[model samples]
Target: MKKILLVCSAGMSTSMLVKKMQETAVKEGKDYEIEALALSEAESKIDDVNVILLGPQVRFQKPQVEKVAGGRVPVDVIDMQQYGMMDGESVLKHAESLME
Candidate 1:
């Protein structure tokens, strides 16, 4: 199973996207572990994740997160439009592609 982590300013804001992503995964028969966390809590959670996706609001922190990730995981910023629209399928596909 792949562990995909989404990070935003407050963590709370990504819950809906997480839900949508989870639903998409289930429908596609993917057993991925999807989750979201506040930027403040991301570092601690990064260790176990296979990929880390940043919310548009927190995209600027990608460098910092990558530093913490230290090449152990792939980190990327979600597309602003996709995030704004809460398009979970796109984001989930993006995450999977990164893992691949």
Candidate 2:
């Protein structure tokens, strides 16, 4: 299964998105592992993740995340509008693209 790592400020709000994405993935019959963690926990989780997604609230940390994630993982910030509106399908598509 592909591994997706999500990072946010407190790791609370993004947990909701994580659930949505997981539901979307399941509905689409995609086999993957998705998890959400606080930005502070990213370093420890990076090694196990195939992709890193950032919540808008933590967009500023993209560079840092990229640095620590090295070149092995794809890292990008979730669209603020999409996230605020909780558009899971779009986010799931974004995550899927990273796998390619």
Candidate 3:
């Protein structure tokens, strides 16, 4: 299974997105382990995740996250519009694209 981690300022806001992404993954028959974490927790969690997605609010921290990720996993920022709309399908698609 693919392990997808979503990071935000406090990990609270992205929890909703995680839920939606989980639902979308199930509906699409995609086997993925989706979770949310605070940016501060990302460094420790990076080794275990297949991809790291940052919430728009934390987009500025991409460089820090990527450094922790160390190119072992793909890192991408969630689009502000899609995130605000809670568009799980698009977000999931974006993640999937990154994995590719």
Worst 10 residues of 1 by lDDT: 39-48
Better of 1 and 3 by lDDT: 1
lDDT per model, in order? Answer: 0.94, 0.91, 0.93
Clashes (N, CA, C under 3 Å) per candidate: 0, 0, 0
Q: For model 3, which pairs clash?
A: none
Clashing pairs in 2: none
TM-scores, each model vs. reference: 0.97, 0.96, 0.97
Q: Candidate 3's residue-wise lDDT over 1-100, tens digit each?
A: 9999999999999999999999999998999999999988878988898899999999999998888788999999999999999988899999999999
Task: Tell me the spans in candidate 1 whose CA falls farther than 4 Å from its real position.
Answer: none
Model 1 RMSD in Å is 0.6
Best model per lDDT? 1
- The residue-level lDDT of candidate 3 at 91 comes to 95
